[model samples]
Target: MEPLVVAMLLLLLARGHSALGLGGRNMWLIKEKVLQAREQRARDHVRGGQRWSSAALGSAQHLEPQEEFFPQPLDHFNRQNNATYKQRYWVNTKLWEPQGGPVFLYIGGEGALTTYSVLAGEHVDLARKYRALLVAVEHRYYGASINPDGLNHRNLHFLSSQQALADLAMMHAFISHRYNLSKLNKWICFGGSYPGSLSAWFRLKFPHLVHAAVASSAPVRAQLDFTAYNKVVSRSLSNPVVGGSPECRATVGAAFGAVDEMLARGESAALERDFRSCRPLDGSGDYGQLAGNLADVVMGIVQYNHELGIDATIAHLCRLMANTRLGAPYRRLVALNANYMERMSLNCTDNSYQRALEELRSEVVKPYGVGERQWYYQTCAEFGYYQTCEDEGCPLSRWLTLRSEVDVCAQVFGISASSVQGAVDFTNDYYGADRPKASRIIFVNGDIDPWHALSVLRNQSRSELALVINGTAHCANMNPPETGDPLSLQHARQIIEEQIGDWLSRRPLYPL
Candidate 1:
């Protein structure tokens, strides 16, 4: 489902490690996670050591964006901190009209940037039609944007949506100057998942800069205990549109239930062996981690259910779960886990709580910190999008409670578990939750994607529209139109195209 989530984290360490790439979703900590190892490794190479170049990010012959960097301030709010860092950005003017052509900025999410963001997509196709300049600005903390000062909790204090927004504001100015853009050269921001939220917020906060926004699968609302997330995952399992059924959902629920029963029966050794836990179950935390890892398999599937129609799909998983020939529910879970791990190229599921604590405690920002620690820092500080499984009908084990997740925040960042709700409140207040008063922003979401539960699923106004495509997965419209795509998905893209054109043709619908 990595390919399914292709949320591709903005889950940062998709090839091997798992981070919150939305914190869990980027960290595709919140959104869909992309699953291909080759694609994930390509992003890692550019992020770890390799410099941004055409060769590093696929072929330019295939319309790969030319890698460029911006001298961004290390701290935008604190003028005293005059230090700066090179923020990565990519631009392609191959389709620019140079006269009244808009700038389509693809906002990079919680993970690293890939050539695919700029080279291919419905936005790129729109760029071709409107003769717009296509650009993608990498989020500061993620990818190669990591600063050398440190990755300590204190140092990471600056990594937040607020700072990322400021970065976008500055980049907007820089790009406008370089390209001679003006009010006539209206800018439309584009993003999916976490970056999708950024797109809508950019328009909300900086309406003077961006004329329109396309926020696909964006979870605009910040939630401390995202129990509803699992509820949607449970429902998605039985969604017949995407090839799901009630029997399948029940089997999935039963499988996790059996896991809990097996644990109670003192079958930790068997559990570890069957699920291939990297470390032996030692304590309550270890047990919870094991359950969490298994749950993520289902989460990834539902989040990006039918994306790419590749391996480890929800249908394939449901079949495995419901297959009577596979033996009991526990055995079915074991088989599903094996298939998912092999597909994800994971040698062993690292359900090590000790290692998790160590990594979060470590001051050193290694290659995979962007997906795990950096994103989690934001989760603890700003958006408490902690995916908990305490929901009534969640298919995951009960071990994955809200406290189990918030405990990490308290231990690592000194963010009290009690204060997480306050952080979430502040986020919702700042962004207006799902009721943002922004205009010309098309909030697109898929019914099957759990993240959509937090997004604007209904139209708030004539200008601030919402497009809820049925049977589609996370950010399905953002991808290039593929053969055999859902009709709703195809229709949503067409509407998005027409709406963007209308926004361009008319004068400011809302006050500038």
Candidate 2:
């Protein structure tokens, strides 16, 4: 009886062991199936993105082509810093070739990918003809390129112009190596507005690697005078045909003066005319045509053309206030005026406004600094970004406190700011050390653009710069001038295409 009981126990133990092993195998199989499914889904998405070219995020599995935006999910290999902090980037490329034509590395400005991609799309044909790969990368803390817990003031201290230049250089090297492409080919760096500043720096820093660079509306001078630019804004408005009326000019001047008075007095009544004559631009909730005019005023002041800027700006206001309907002409004018103003406003508000606000505080408590004293201290304390005031504005008023300690002339413009200052610092920086070798650079501008001071910078740049069109708006390459304009805009397009094609065919023997 004892032997029989022992045999039964041994049999039961063996069966239990076998069942446990089988269960473990089944679990492993399930996990493998799930992973496979995810990979397949990812591939399908990638395939869809083939229709529209995509910027890459690295992936373990091979990506496929498709006709949708973000068709597939790319994987990232996170590398942590000493603090266990990780930075994220998308490094996968679908259309990279080893010995392709010249690579056009297009850096983006302050805006998101939507704006960048649109610009890229417009120049797609030329890009393909050059056998060039167009890369549109997002800056840190902007768009999909995010740094988790990286946007606060403390961390943002790292996101300076110097760091941004480093980021561009690193990305360029990484892409060239990863795709097995020859870095020796012509590398053209180009961008407008904020990114234009980056382009200028990139050319200066990596002169050997970059064959050519085109920077438009780039503000390299750290200490820009915002109040001074009102001259340009006023000039744009004084066009004889549109804004040149005597009554229009008087109204604009009076309105601006009132705002100045209000700023000095800190009274809400100073905004009475601006509020009364202004009504919301159709579709814009509370914003009015007056806001658009104010933008023109600000722009005119920047380029030393205040009379035209103010005249055009006020005339535009009159036009808008007269027509509550928000018709086609009004819309077009508003768009053109507002577009230039938008960029101008943002730069002043972010870089200049904060400085002015700080200056105002210091004025009452202490002596004034280098900036305009009257404009430095404002009576109002509650103004915020995107919130336009009817009273006077202190564009450079905010930039009064924090003096940019960086040597703008020596370190930036290839000159010493200790001796010279203002736009000259920026002009010398762009033209002196960062000169482009290749003759394919193109400068596109609108005649009436408030930021036309950019033209002065272009003129200062080394030779081989071509102004494609004379527009009364911003970025009019895609939007050509009407039939009679003297500028050969169509010819400009042909020249651009031919030059790009030639460069791609035979890479320039640029200095490296």
Candidate 3:
């Protein structure tokens, strides 16, 4: 594999955050940043599960997982179309009891899955305790499950959260029948971020298929104008708990404000040189891409705040932005962006609109965007979690507006901006958004994770409990209990385990 692919693989292993289909990533760079994680599993095995330099922090423990595939129907909702596609999956029976064990199904999101996905992380730990059968199904249109008909508008019509949930239900039957699973063996589903939403939806849609669900940093609400996303990012940047301060957030806003001034002044040449843009920022779209990439650096740091792999923590970024010797706020942003690019092994940051369009418009999977294109289609059709900056207290440029983002929907998929709102409403109406009338689901979110703004933070009901960790970021509870973990995160995980135990034991989480 190329160094670029390897470098990108490291980011994908983070697992909780999204390269596409989330608030922070809705309008972010689609080119170099879209290194879909399909290849990470193979690379990790070659390097022996330790390719990630940071903590391997949340990686699974199972080694030598048995890989398999099931011929899943392409259009699960279409009863007539019997055309099936081979869906890749992995099973680890290391901890399963010979007599009977619970099935811990790891639902893949917008990307591929590695054996590490099935073997590692918090769910695997639970699987061990419960002696559960560990199985992971790659989401349709991602990794080896990409539909053979291609990603055209017509083919992608079948790709929706509704259909994906059906895929999960079908997989449950396939795996249960294959394992000879009986009613004694209950199913517990797990996922984070977009997959996290899937986990919640799976329980909501098919209560019989899954007994319980643990959704981490799951954005259950779908909205077109996700301005609240950056609003939360702004707050997180000011959170002193994670090394953020008023000055840090102020500096970010000032930096983007200065960049906007430069762009308005038509000083594209100097701006490109300062930010190390690979191409000239000639048009409005390229300029918007530049703004989006700069904002992406801050958004990613905040979303993955204090996570193991990301070297550039909020503290590191704030320190760079605070250095007065860096000159102005734009200069400080330049320094920070420089560090982020270097961390990702990127030589020159491409801020070309046409280049991004080429990636989004392509039918075949590109090396860079293995699933981003597919994810973009989903956002256009179903969920419009576009992280725009037009809202108040936004630290990024105003040019990264809902209009600019919805334009991608129009340009590539011909999805009108007006239609986007309808799709988002449909998603929320269908799944019940954050307040979905579902039982036996524990929705987990970290205060610092912007996606939390859309999750179930408060206790909606006893059965549908919400656990929000005070001093943590995206999917913090989903990682194994570490020494440096905050007390709140530790407690949150305990509550999750308790809930799972109750669900399995048939104990009512709430009394009537």
Say which candidate scores most in lDDT: 1
lDDT of 1 by residue, 1-512 (tens): 11322342222233433322112211233232363432453445434433334543345464456678898887899999997877888997767778889999999867777665666677877887898988899998777777766476556877889889999999999999998887778899999989999999999999988989999999999998887888898889999888889999988888887776665455789999999887798755666677777887788878876552466578888778888998988899899889877766678877777777777777664433235677778888888877776555788776566766777788788899778889899999999999998888999999989999899988999999999999988888887665688889889999999999999889755764
Instruction: Please report, in order, the local distance difference test score of every candidate based on alpha carbons.
Output: 0.77, 0.38, 0.76
Summarize candidate 3's per-residue lDDT along 11-119 as a digit string, tens digits. 4335532122212232243222322221342344324532322232234443457678888788876779987777779987777874657899999888767666675
RMSD of 3: 8.7
TM-score of candidate 1 on Cα atoms, chains taken together = 0.88
Ranking by TM-score: 1, 3, 2
RMSD of 2: 24.3
lDDT (tens digit, per residue) of candidate 2 on 1-512 = 12442353244345531100000011112223322333343344334453344343235244322211211111112234323222223322334344655666666543333322322332434454455565655544344443454433244334444545666676777667756666555677666545665666676667766766655545433332223233344454455543444343344454444333333232423232323322222211111123323443333332322222333343455454234364433243333344433533332211122232233223231111111211111001000001122223322111111112112122222323333343334444544422333344555454555444433335443434545344344333432123443355466556656655654566446843
Sequence-dependent TM-score of model 3: 0.87
Off by over 4 Å in 2: 1-98, 115-122, 226-228, 240-250, 261-442, 454-468, 478-491, 502-512
> Which candidate, 1 or 3, would have the higher lDDT against the true structure?
1
2 versus 3: better TM-score goes to: 3
* lDDT score for candidate 3 against the true structure: 0.76
TM-score per candidate, chains pooled: 0.88, 0.53, 0.87
Evaluation by lDDT, superior candidate among 2 and 3: 3
Ranking, lDDT, top scorer first: 1, 3, 2
Error of 3 at 175 (Å): 1.1
